[model samples]
Target: MTPRPRKQVLLRLDPAVYDALARWAGEELRSANAQIEFLLRRALGEAGRLPGAAGPLPRRGRPPKNPGGDTPADE
Candidate 1:
């Protein structure tokens, strides 16, 4: 038998807060859950806490060139 998918947990918030979240979610064309997830990701990304998150890194010279030798440096 296949394992069942994990269940999602629901959070209860103050009515006013929930209403605000709902309105923000509607404005962004996302469900409350999706809006929360997006907010969490953005927060983590800003804090450099997300796994495999892209941020500024030390420059390692120019990026690799494509297979063709048509790169500007080749000119």
Candidate 2:
């Protein structure tokens, strides 16, 4: 199934929490936003709130399979 488009979200985290997230992101080689998404997915998965297999939320974007079976060079 195709994934849905992403919507912009604004979160107001405490200063300390934001700082810790930034640090964790650096350590994990991920952007702060990515880290936050990962954390949220993990939490949701643990709580069985994920849509399927109790897995992390799917990343928002098209899947790798090309509907027309075309390669990058075809375009």
Candidate 3:
């Protein structure tokens, strides 16, 4: 099935807060936007407000190679 488009949001944060978030994200190797989403999801889950149908976070980085050691570029 085709994946749905992700929603875009505009957020405003204090410089100090943003800096802290950016640093935390960097430590975790995640983007600021991703870090925000992760925290939001965690909070929602803890509060039992997360939708049952909510999908998991999308995978990051390169896709896995085939067992035959072939990739799309090799095809």
Candidate 4:
């Protein structure tokens, strides 16, 4: 199935806040944008405001090279 298209938003933050968020994101190995989304999701879940249809966050890294479980020699 085709994935839904993501929405874009324009956000404004104080320089100090942005720097702190960037540092936290770097420590967690996520982009600042992803870190923001993660925090939002966590906040929603904690407040019982998350939607039932909300999907899990996207996978973080590259897909497996041999997804079909085929040996390289077989190819």
lDDT of 1 by residue, 1-75 (tens): 333454488888899998999999899777777777778778988998977834332223355576346676656
Name the TM-score of candidate 1: 0.56
Q: Per-model C-alpha lDDT, please? A: 0.70, 0.77, 0.88, 0.91
Q: Which model scores highest in TM-score?
A: 4
Worst 10 residues of 2 by lDDT: 53-62
lDDT (10s digit) by residue, model 2, range 1-75: 545666689999999999999999899877788889889888877998866744344544566676556686458
Worst 10-residue lDDT window, candidate 4: 66-75
For model 2, what is the error of residue 1's alpha carbon versus the real structure, in angstroms, after optimal superposition? 7.2
19 Cα displacement, candidate 1 (Å): 0.5
For model 3, the run of ten residues with the poorest summed lDDT: 66-75
The C-alpha stretches of model 2 lying farther than 4 A from their native spots are 1-3, 53-75
The pairs that clash in candidate 1 are none
RMSD of 2: 4.5
For residue 5, model 3's alpha carbon misses the true position, in angstroms, by: 0.5
After superposing candidate 3 on the true structure, give the runs of residues whose Cα lies further than 4 Å from its correct spot. 63-75
In candidate 3, what are the lDDT values of residues 1-75, reduced to their tens digit?
666889999999999999999999999988999999999999999999999988888776655776346666656
When 2 and 3 are scored with TM-score, the better candidate is 3
- Please give the lDDT score at residue 14 for candidate 4: 100
lDDT, ranked from best to worst: 4, 3, 2, 1
- Each candidate's number of clashing pairs is 0, 0, 0, 0
